[model samples]
Target: LSVVQDQIDDLKISLNISLRIVLIGKTGSGKSSSGNAVLGWSEFKSDLSQTSVTKLCQKAQGRVEGRRVEVVDTPGLFDSTMSHHEVNEEMLKCISLLAPGPHVFLLVLQIGRFTPEEKETLNLIMKAFGKDAQKFTIILFTHGDKLEDYGLSLEEFIQKKCDDSCKKLISDCGNRCHVFNNKEKDTERKYIQVRGLIKKIDDVVRANGGGCYTNEMLQEMKRKMEEMEEKFKQEMQKMQQRMEEQRDENEKVLQERDNELKELKTNIKRERTLREEEQKNCNLFFHNITIIGPYFQKCAKMNQSFAQK
Candidate 1:
């Protein structure tokens, strides 16, 4: 019995699942940089630019400490270049990429550059994902070197230096946070930070009972897409049917007009023929009257002379 139980436990251990992580943040928050750091190499482009570097949802995967990890980098939530509809579409696209869904969402933030959009990020996430999004979120602060330059620990900065909104954000995320210094060239230190981040991720997964965060919003979007496609097909069919019906009706009308025109032409020709014949008859009668007029007069004179005698 002991041997059998040991074998079962070994089988269960081999079933350790992979991690699917999605990054969310405002533009210029070093989301791409953090993703590269997590994967211990560069899989996404990172740079200093006023414009958003990522315009679409992109996914990259690698092995971290012998565990499979997938990172999905998304466009900034409040990028000015993108409209509201466009941003929502990209987010939905991100959700679709991580179908059935992400085990954790790393809410990327800069060390000391929290803006108004950053403050409203949680609200947006709730609006997009749901209220339960907070449960599966982990706050990830990039540019750790800045915090080091300030000579402040992560906890100290949160308690003393960070603004009220930032503090509230951290609190809301259950104080589950990690910092990454992408500029750190020391492989050991980078490895340590990545390992720590992964540990927190494992904790989040455990807390959620080994289940990923699934959103009804994703399912709803899919349903809407299907409905719209079906509606478009139906509309196209109706338009084609209407066009075909109109074409047949036009042909019928044209045929009737053509028949009516032919009948009118025949009637006009008959009337012309009758008029010509009547004119001819009148001309003949006048000619006959003119020829007999002289003859009649001579006959009348002879009859008068005979009576006198």
Candidate 2:
């Protein structure tokens, strides 16, 4: 009974364990096909077009060798003619699809098609995703038929055909690479490739402390967003304070003006009263002068008559 219980418990634990992978690359680099091959089904749309085929991110879930596996297929990272904003938006969506994050990033590359543009795209991926991405990244090469045509193994191809920068990129990824031939219909080959890829992913996970790839760029973005929110809050507070101060200043000015108006009115009333009093005195003086003038004239006339007599 104890042995049976332990077996059941182990099975449960195995069922709970899952592997998440995110595929990223430029247009026509066979990312979608590679994803389908990895999942052992045609879950993602694969095509050979002059333009980008995968316009959005797609996620597919499956069980491989008793392990739950989830693969995220993303649009080409750096499609020519796409604006930076558009690319960034799509990349952000890819990250969101990965949710908490991915266990490994499959940087898809075409076998024998490494160009200067592809090199630049790789650099862009490193720059945009951050340096930490390399720790959990695997350089997945698609179109493995190219290797057969050249009669070379993957190692031979990388050694002879790849340039210095390409070699460095592989080295940076810890030389973690795998080749898949999506065109091949052999079930055994497919199984072997998928198994090998999953094993490599397991190895990477174990080597990296059993943790998924840490999205430092995403974390940094979150931190920056928090800072921006804080800044916005501070600015709003400052604006509110300024508005309050302006209101108080305006009230003070209005109060001062009202006080000045009241003083002017009082002065006007006082001046009017003084003018009235002055006018009354002037009237009284005018009346007295008229009567005295008449009296003086009569006295002068009497004196003249007495002198004549």
Most TM-score-accurate candidate: 1
Best by lDDT: 1
Kindly provide the TM-score of model 2 when superposed on the true structure, using C-alpha atoms: 0.65
Q: After superposition, how far is residue 235 of candidate 2 from its true place, in Å?
A: 22
Show the lowest summed lDDT stretch of 10 residues, model 1.
5-14
Q: Estimate each model's TM-score.
A: 0.66, 0.65
Instruction: Tell me the tens digit of each residue's lDDT in model 2 across 1-309.
Output: 966755664454344467889888878889988888877788998878648777777899887886888898877766666765677566666666766678788999999888777776556665556556778799999999999999999999999999998998898889999999878888998989999998898777766656675566667756776798899999999999999999999999999999999999999999999999999999999999998999999999999999999
Residue pairs with clashing backbones, model 1 = none
For model 2, state the Cα shift of residue 168 in Å: 1.3
Candidate 2, poorest ten consecutive residues by summed lDDT: 7-16
What ranges in model 2 sit over 4 Å off? 1-16, 215-217, 221-309
